[model samples]
Target: MSKLSTYVHVPMENRITVTLLCCASFVCIESLRKNWRPALTHLSNGLRIIESLPMSMLNKLRDTVSIYGSANNTEEELGMDYILRLFATWEVSCALFAENFKPVISVKLYRGRELDDKPLDEFESITQAHRAIVQYTRDIFALVWLFRDHQGDDQFWSQPIPRRQHEILSHRGDCMGGLFERFMAKPQAPPSGTGEHYSLQWLPPTVYPNLIASLGIEGRFKLWAEDPSAAPGRRFSASNRATTSKAAYEMRSAKYPYRSFSMKHNEETRHTYLALLASDGRLMVFENEQPENMSEYTPIDELSICTKPSRGEEVSFKVRFDPNPDPCYNAMQAGVANDSLALVVAGMAAVKIYRSRDVITTSYGVAQTQREFYLALEVGVHRGLVRDVAWAPGNIRGHDIIATACQDGFVRVFRIDTPHSSNEGKSWSTSELPRYENHQVQTCSRAGQLNDKQQHQSGLSASLAKSGSHAERHFSGQLGQVKHACKEIAKLDSHRTPVWRVGFDDDGQILASTGDDGKLVCYRQTPSGDWAKSSELAIVKTRMATP
Candidate 1:
C-alpha cells in the first residue's frame, strides 16, 4: 500500500452539464445510452491538476522510475518512488489510450517538402528527411489530436487514416521495416546556414532513437502491429506469440541520453518548449512545429492544440551553445523562460546561457530563440561534479538567480551578473590552452570568445583536432586539459552527503535541495529578500527491518 489521494469527489457516472452546452457536443447527441460522466469527470479533474502546473502525467511517472531506476535508487529502499508513478501513469495513460479518448492535443511533423493532401498512412519512408514535429496543447481536458503529415484529420490512431494497420507488410531480415533502426544513422545535418533559421523555430534535437522508444506503442505504430488480425496477410514476429508482444516496445525504449526534466504544459503558449540536457554533453530543444500556433501568444490557460500545421521552409524558432571546450559531465540541469526568454543549461564544469534575439510580440515565440549562445560562466566547484541547476522566475528582475546542487556536498546559489557575448558558430579556442596555468580562471571569461586574431590561431588548433589520431596524440602528449569556474552568489554546505538536486519554485520565493541523506531542505525568501531555511522533509522514514 502507498500514499494516495482520492481527488475525484464525484462519481464517474456524473455528467458535467446537460443543458445548453450539449448542442455543440457529439456526446450530448449520443447521451441516450452512454454515460458521458467519466469523460466529464476527467475534464474537471484534469483542470484541477493543471492549475498546479505539474509535469505531464507521463513525465511525473517517469520521474518516480528515475529515482528508483537501476542507475539511481533501489526498489526495496525506495519503494516510495513507485507510488506516485503508479497512480499518475495509470490514470493519465488509461485516459490517453481509452477508446475514443485522447490525451495529447496534437502532433504535426515537417518533412521538408510539399506534403500529399491526404494524411500520411505511416512515417515518411526511410529515404525521406523527417526534420520536425509540432505539439499543440488543446484547451479541453487531457485529450489531444495529431496530424503527422500536416494535412490530415485530427485523430491520430484512426479516422483520418490508420497507418499502423500495416507498417511492415513483409519481413526481410532482423528488422521488419524498423523505422527506428534507420534513425540511428546520422541524417545529414540540417543544411548549414539554415542553422539560424531552424534555431529560430526549434531547439537542438536530442538523441532521437531513445526519444522514439519513450513514445511506447504510439511511437513505431505498434498498436495494430502487435495484433495478428490487424494485418491478415502478414505474419507477426515469432516473439509476438498471439498478442503478448510488449517485448518489442520494451526493448526499444531504453534510456535517452537527454531525458526530459520539465516542459511548459498546453495551457502555456506554443512558444514554451520541452527542455532536456544530455549526460553526453548536449542540450536538446523541442518546440511545436505548428505554422499557425507560431502566430499567437495566448496565456497558458487559453492555449491548446493548433487546428492546422503547414509544410513550409520558412518556419521554426532556435539557440546554440558552442561544442564543449572539454565536453564532459556526470549530470545536467536546465530552465526555460518567457518574453525575450532566457534559457540556461549547465553540467560537469560549465554553465551556458542562451537568450531570445528579442521579445516576441505575437503568441508563438520560438523564433526568438537565437543560434548565438552566451557562455555566461564556467563553474569549477573544487573540481566536483554539479548535480542540479535551477532559475528563479522574475521578468522584472531578469532571471539572475540560480541554484545548483553539487557532489561536493553543498548547494550553491549563483547570480548571472555579466553582459555575456553571443558566440554563434564559434568553437571554443583550443589553441590557447598552454598559454595559461589556471585553466579554470583562464578560459571562464569573455576573452575565451574567438575574435579575428584568435580565430586564426583557432583554425590551426581546429585543424589539428580534425587531423588523424596521430595529431591528437601529439597534442595530448604536449598540452594538458583546461579547468574553468563560474562565480556563485552563495554556497550552503549544510548537507553531509552529496546534494543531488536543487530548484526554485515559479516565484523566486522558495528554494529546495535534496540529498543522499533522504532529507529535503527548503528555504524561503525573507521579507528583506534573503533565502533562509524554512523546512525539512524526510523522504526515507527511519524504519526497522521486517522479519
Candidate 2:
C-alpha cells in the first residue's frame, strides 16, 4: 500500500489548532515500497497540499495527519472556551493513539509538552491490572471530553462511583488521576492536600498530551453530535422550545448527543433511526436512506439521513404519550423494532407507540413517510408521566416487550403482544414474511386505557372463556393490524425520584436505566421471563462544599 500519512508541526500553546489539524490532516508515513512513491490524498478542493514533507522517518509518522498550516481565527471566551476546557485532556488521548500507530515522538510536539509543564513518562505498564484500569480510564476520560453536557459539570470526568447516598459527590467532584491510583493501589498515595493544576488522568502512563490530537474526518462529524452550543439548558418548557434550531439539532449534531445516553439501531432490519428527545416533549426521527429492496437495508450514513423533506418542511411530532400534554413534556426515550413495524415512545406521560403493517415504511418495504406515522398504541404506565421506553428485539415468547422510566420515579416493564393474533415481530421474519390472521386482542389491563383518538376504533379482546360477543372481541383489536399493544409487566419503585431512561441492551436479555438520583441500574432477565435488578453504577452530580 502506498503511504497516505502526514505529519503536523505546532510550536506553541494552541492545542485546539492541533486538534483541528488532527481532524483535517492525515499522518504522512514513508512509503513501505522500496522503489515507488505513494500518492497523497487531499480532503476538499482548496486544501493546499503541503508537498515535500521530509519523509526521513519510517513508521515514525504513522496514523497521523501532517498539518502544515497557520491559524486564521481567534478563540473566544463564550464560544471556544467550553470546548477548550472539555478537550483540555484530549492531547493526552492523541498521544496514546500516536504511540499505538507510531512510537517516535515529533520534535515540535516534544518541545510544546515541556513548555506546558506536562512532562512525559515512559509509556509502559507495571501490571496487567493497572493496565486494564489505565485503558478504561483513557476511554471514559475521552468519553467525558466528547460527551459531557457542560464544563461546570466536573463530576462527569472524575466523580466517584458512590455505593451509599452519603458518598454521592453532590458537594464536590473528584480529581482526575485519583480514581486510577485508588483502583491500582499504587505504591505511594496521591498527594494529600495540594490542589495544583494537574491532568492527573491525562498524565499517567507517560503523558502524550497531544497524542493523535485530531478528531479526524470521521471524528469531525462525530463532534457535530456533541457541540456544546446546542446542548439543552436546565429550564425548559413547551412555549420556550429547546434552544437548538432545526438546523443545529440535526443527527450529525446530536447523535448520542446527550451525556452518557445510549443510542440504539434496529437489529433485524435495514432501516436505521436516531431519535432525539427535545426539551419540550418532542421526538425527532432521523432515518437512513430508503433501501432498494426488502432483503436490503441501505447502510446508515452520516450524510444520507433525512433531515429536510422535499418541500423544505419540518415535522415536530407531538409527545401525546406524556401523561399530561398541557405543559412542556420531558420527552425521554424512543425505540424501534428490529422488524421495523413497531415503535415505542416514553416520557412524562403515557407510553406511546406506532405499530402498523408498516407504519415506518411504505407498501414496497421502503422507508415510511413521516405522514404515515400516528399513535397506534398509547398506554398509561405510571400515574405520573413516563420517562423512558425500550423495546426488546423479537422474542420467542411471542410479544413486543418494552421497558419504561417514569417521572413517578419507577422503572417499569411492559409487553405489547397479541396471543390470539400473530401480532408478534414476524413483521419481516424472513425474505418473505408470514402473515398471521388478525385475531381479537384478548386483553387490555383493567387499569390501562388507550389515549389516541384511534384507540376508540381499536378494542381489546379477552380470553376465549371471558368473551361476551364477537363485537366486543373485535373492538379490542382496533389498533389497526396490531393487538395487545401494552400490558404491564412489573413496575418497580426503582428510584426515589424520576427515572430518566430505560433500555434493553442489544441482546434483549438485560435491561438498564438511569435516574435523577444519578444512578444506573441494570436488570437481567431470568429464564422464566422475569426481570431482576442486578447491578448499579453511580454518576452523581457535584454537591457544593459545605461552608
* Per-model TM-score versus the true fold: 0.33, 0.34
Model 1 lDDT tens row, 13-85: 2222221122223333343335666544544354333334334432333221234325444434244234332
Candidate 2, residues 1-547: lDDT per residue as tens digits? 1111223344344433344343333322222222112212211110122111233321222212222221332333222333322232333444453332211122222222222222123222233334333333433343333333545655653544312211322211233255445534654433332223201111111211111111122212111212233347412111112333211111223332211112233333333344433323334444545421111122221111112223422222212111110111111001122233334555446566653222222223222222123444667646665655666753644455777777678888887654342333334333223212111111122112222222221122211222232232122433334334567777777668778667676567888888877888899877776788889898664434445
- Cα RMSDs, all models: 25.3, 26.1
lDDT of each: 0.36, 0.36
lDDT of 1: 0.36
Q: After superposition, which runs of candidate 1 have C-alpha atoms over 4 Å from their true positions? A: 1-256, 259-269, 291-339, 356-371, 418-487, 527-529, 539-547
